[model samples]
Target: MGLVLGDAWLWAAVEWSPPAVAEFYIGGGFDTPTVVALLVAALVKAALLWLILRAPAPGPLDRRAKALRRLLYLAVAYALVLRYPIALLPDAVDAAFQLALWTAIDVLYLLVIRWRSRMLRAAAGAVFAVELAAMADVLLDELDLPELGSGYIVELALMLGGVAATLITLVGQRRDGRWSRGTQTAGWLSVGVYALVFPLDVFGRMSGGDMTVPVMMDALGYVGTVWIAATARELPAEGRPADLPPARRRVIRVAVTAVAVLPIIALIHPEATPHLTYTGWSMDCYDRPSFGDLKPAERDAAFLCRARSTEGGVPPMFPDSLSDQEILAYGRALCRAKDRDEQRALLTRAGSASARSADQWDLVYVCPEIVGAAHPELLWSTTEAEAANAAYIAEKNAKCRDPWPRTKGVVQATANYFLFVDGDPGYLVHDPEDEAADEAAEQAMGKVYDDSTRVGVTDSAVLIGHVADVADVCLTVKAFRTPPPQRTAGWDQVNEVPIVSRSGQLTVPEMGEGGEVGAGAPMPNLAIAGKGRYRLRVYVRVDDAEEEQHLVVVFPGASRKRLKLKPRPVAGRALSFNSPSSGGRRAVARGAGGRSQAELWS
Candidate 1:
């Protein structure tokens, strides 16, 4: 009876998410709190075992069953004691205490009297060793060592222990004869539980499913095998406790455990398809393509094809082998060209890169923005691009300009993203003078990310993570003729990077309704219309409990002839992402970030 009750208690813990667990199981009174159920069950188990001292041994069978039950109860004791304690002791001392607890459990099983099976004892040792390693992870943590495989250690150990126990039970059933059919069946059922659980723990996570799924599966299996063994009354025992109980009693125990565990899992876990939370253009061709793999023309095409909003969901035509240098030269010449027709003719010249790809919308939209002071080359640009640019500047001047050097505005923090204010998304995709881009990418993702890591930064973009998931942020953008002697008051973090613009037009591109499937439209882009390097210093303040503020300041930079810039690797959703619960309202903080909602890549 005590063992049967333990099964129900284990089920209660399955609703582990806490006060959120349903007040009533189904049509009412399943209202047991998880901790209360576990504590009561632990006491009941201890009480039943201690009562053995007052009476003669029931039989060898019952004594062996009691021995097994004692080891199982320690799981609860471990939680009540060590697991719940806020370890105030030194690292080595805490480690030693846990080691001691596992050692005592192992000793108890080793002294199993009459019906001991060698394999079952071996399984106990396996459990002890695994648990010690899992628990000792905190020691390495305290020493400030890198957490090598710490996240999955406990789950892996549990799976391995289940494998050990399952095998031993099956082997013991045959070797220790005197087992009834029901007892034999219980051994096989344990094996089935392991088979179902191990794969979900491994594969489910790789596929990006919620982690809780596998844990819940393991819980169901745990409660199940215990229920089966409890009802069959079959284990290596002095009285051949492998003997089965009456059919009616067996039915009652089976019914009790099933009723306790299955209902809660069914009621609590939502049935939903897996939603992959990746950042990329909805129509993007691939992620972080290797520049070295493509020829010059293909590489240029690849760059143009990357996350940029084009009309009708169509990607821009290849750059037609047009390099940024060639385009910049064309813009410089157009500076001397006389009228709109001459400017149009200059771009439309036969066999030129511009003429060869004159019909592409991105090139058209970007052409005017790049050649900032040139003729109104509406022939190579679109009305929409012209209109967006005009409105953007007007809004900027109204809010940011009147304030003189600093312009304060509310940046739309949509879908947890902001800006990639580069003149070109494909900047330095093919430069050979330096390998900084590749090295920077390797460094950004070279190690596992920790909980505090809210963002990823590469030469391509600055991944601003909403650590607190703030939707809209108040910020100021200022253009400086030179860097300030020191950071202004009120900012908490600071960094300066060189911005390279091919067209001299820097833009803040944002995602629209299409999400990762489509390269998003642009917000107002800054027309820094000269092909030169510039310094951008960003100051971020996140200490505000309600809002995040960023100060972006840009200034001219001297040219460096050491090496050509390497395009940095982007990480995460380079385009954009929306959490399932996001209301679809867009508010992005895209100052140092890049075009499209996709922020970065691996």
Candidate 2:
């Protein structure tokens, strides 16, 4: 049974990210709110252990009674070791001693508890130890520490205690010649409970839900096993005090434990918003991805504000062509070429590493962005080669811009927009002589680019835009409205919606279809207004197949508007216009030099 419960915890840790357990896996050293929670839990657990120890013990023990006592002590001690492995260890030899200790405990549990299967206990211990060790390794990597940090000693002690208790229970069952009803029930129920509880715990963690739920479940299982075993198991007559009812005492113990742990579990799980804020994009993230792994669609939400908007049954403008990966690669390439150091810094800030592939999008994009600044020679040579390439692309698709830097300083913004491609995204340094040289270069570029005005920094280069002004720039998601055949008079858009910032820095803007945009939602037809440089995110849960444009209309003084896309559905109706430009609508395919770049990575 002891082995079974241990296995339960092991399975939970590996198969699913149990909340408290996940920290250990993610290089537990990256101190976050969750880490703090673990520390607090350790303290609370200690208090509980102290209280349990002080509780009055039932009198003289029969063999079974003796076993139960040992089991209780072992479990409590093991729990402590898990939290503070070095509490009883010497400083220098702590790590080595801890590993040895846990290993010894495994042996003790398997050997001592004759009734409980040895193999099962060993299996559980092996799994648990491996996971803990893995987590410790991650933590060490995060800290750049050469060795696993302290805590193993404590874990070993705790394991030892749990083993002792399991052994005691088996002895009692054997001495009685047959298992008591409660003992038998606990053993069976434990197996089933172990299987179920850990899975639930893992699922909850992966889903990024409240951690409290699973921890509570564990406590409940533990207490339940104890309660069941105490009540149904025949008590050894020698250990019983005639005056006290063992059943009642056991119930009290269970109740007290449950009550004590309730608050502890609550403390372990708190409302956490795992959103990371960075330049250009606001992201709600949990585990940060490796830098290069971020897909283009994810980057799009931050860079271009390409979230789908729904109104009047209008289908959102999804880049029917681009895959998320392609988009991100393109974006990275563009950023990197134009602004190498800064782009590298961005990836680093986002918890990503530098690029290994020169053919990567970051490299490609940077090639053009810094043609004059960093790659002047390449710019001159590539320009001619690019022109030939452009001519070929232009033949295939008029919408495609063959010469990437189509116009001097102009880069195709997407199939939908244009940016000056010739101009460097920011200034770059040629080879720096030393650290001091690098700093000097950065400072010089900072001044040239007006770092104070720029929205972000690219290594030594400034983005050459104000973060606030950048945030205020209106990046519209254009939707062509195709009204329904039957337009109703009362048919007005349910105006309230949000232009969420993916970076998670600013509070979500209030937007709506009509009237004043209230808190939380915005009113449509209004310009998306705000003060900071921010990417807009629009999501339409509604199924409207109408063409509707979501616009981020910036008002002076940092106020912004979220124009709700209220397109009237066109049911199989073909409406032709002389020109898209005639009605002030931007032509998506106006310029023909190369194939139109697809924004959505389909």
Candidate 3:
């Protein structure tokens, strides 16, 4: 009972270890809450069992009971090693540690077996010896092992140990005339557990339906350990002589059969046998707001279906009902419907016929009309969605269509730089109260031609400068492997700026419609390598827009505007310098000696 209670406590710690234990217990150096809890509980059980052992009770300790109690302590130790800690070990050492640990526990188990007669004890010992021999490679230090190979050997040894023990018990029972189906021993029952649990564990873990595999496995193992101890405890002194009642014997056989069948049924239909299970968490689809309650088989089918349906998108999972299938098929059907009335008809028919929930949620975008009052958020009118979508695209087109017009060298332009593609002095006329969205759009645009020459360039057009009043301004670009020495002393202004590229291409786009945001189309294609620093030299004779020859010297360096050549104003940024009132040209502020404030000439 102490052993079982101890297991219960440890199992609680295991179940709660993740969030609960991790949330609270962060003191010990080990940092493993489950391990600490398990070890502590196991130790407590050991102490309690030891106290029980030492307590002088009656004549002699019932030898079989004493053996079983000692075995319970061994089982407690086994339980300690049974979970979480072993998994935390490095796989290289995990195998070796597992072998050593289990070997020690098995050795302890061997020392604890107290059979009725000398021959029984000797037979058990001999069977154990053979089992140990079969697993000799585990203790043998020279055996080279793969990663987890030793662990596999340990598992095989355990299974083989069970097989050997069961066989020996059966042979001995047969020889001693103790063989009786009605009162089959624990060893006979253990074979079923060993056989069934391995497959169940494998399938359950791989089932994908089971979210609580680790917790459930630990729990089932704990139960199995308790059952083993219980069976061990039932061994009688003087072996329950031939005077044992037939009714009691028959009851044992029935109990054994029932016990063996119950667990298998529980694994297959855990929802039906919820009492038998440890963890209640699973994809049972029972209480979820799907449609209605699922029968046990339907629930099981849906759970496994969802689990195994690991395809591209969420696969259609439903109980075996054509009505459910029809509801699932409605997603595609509504999309093909001619109009809202037709869609409503299709949805109503399906909804009336089946109680299954819509399988694909994202399909709401396709079939929005089906999103009735139940899901009010999705109850958006088609016109509203289209309007919103059109608004979204128009906004994208307005903001992302072209790069901001910017000027390079000093002397601000009187005309030519169109601040917006739509020729709006402010911005998209559609956005009145939503200037914040426009501002967000501009910030996302990533390039700004502010009052400062030392500017943060974006992947917008590499450079947009203002060369005023050009009949046909000749713009030629020269790329440099290394920066050529600057000769802009005589030049009007030299603006050294950094060129930024995200698409890996930079270019001087002709004054036209650039494509959408990041995918800006350059002159037909693109070039000037990648993002790097550039130095632009502007030469002007003060009135040179007629045949302005602008030579942009591109190089990899840093950005530093020619300071003091143009002093920047604190405020009064023009919405568009290319004002419609200015005969489709930009107006600039002129300062001392008729010199313009700020501009990008190219």
Judge candidate 2 at residue 408 and give its lDDT.
24
Q: What overall lDDT, based on C-alpha atoms, would model 3 receive against the true structure? A: 0.39
Error of 1 at 250 (Å): 15
TM-score of each: 0.29, 0.28, 0.33
For model 2, the stretches where C-alpha displacement exceeds 4 angstroms are 1-101, 115-427, 431-433, 447-602
Give each model's whole-structure lDDT. 0.40, 0.34, 0.39
RMSD of 2: 25.1
Model 1 per-residue lDDT tens digits across residues 27-66: 3333344334444544543443342222222444456456
| Residue-level lDDT for 537 in candidate 1 | 55
lDDT tens digits by residue: candidate 2, 31-117? 344333343444444444343444433444455445554554554454434435554554434444444444554444344343355
Q: Local error of candidate 1 at 375, Å? A: 31
How much is 87 displaced in model 1, in angstroms?
A: 16
Q: After superposition on all CA atoms, what RMSD does each candidate show versus the true structure?
A: 22.5, 25.1, 18.1
**Candidate with best lDDT:** 1
lDDT of 2: 0.34
- TM-score winner between 1 and 2, please give it: 1
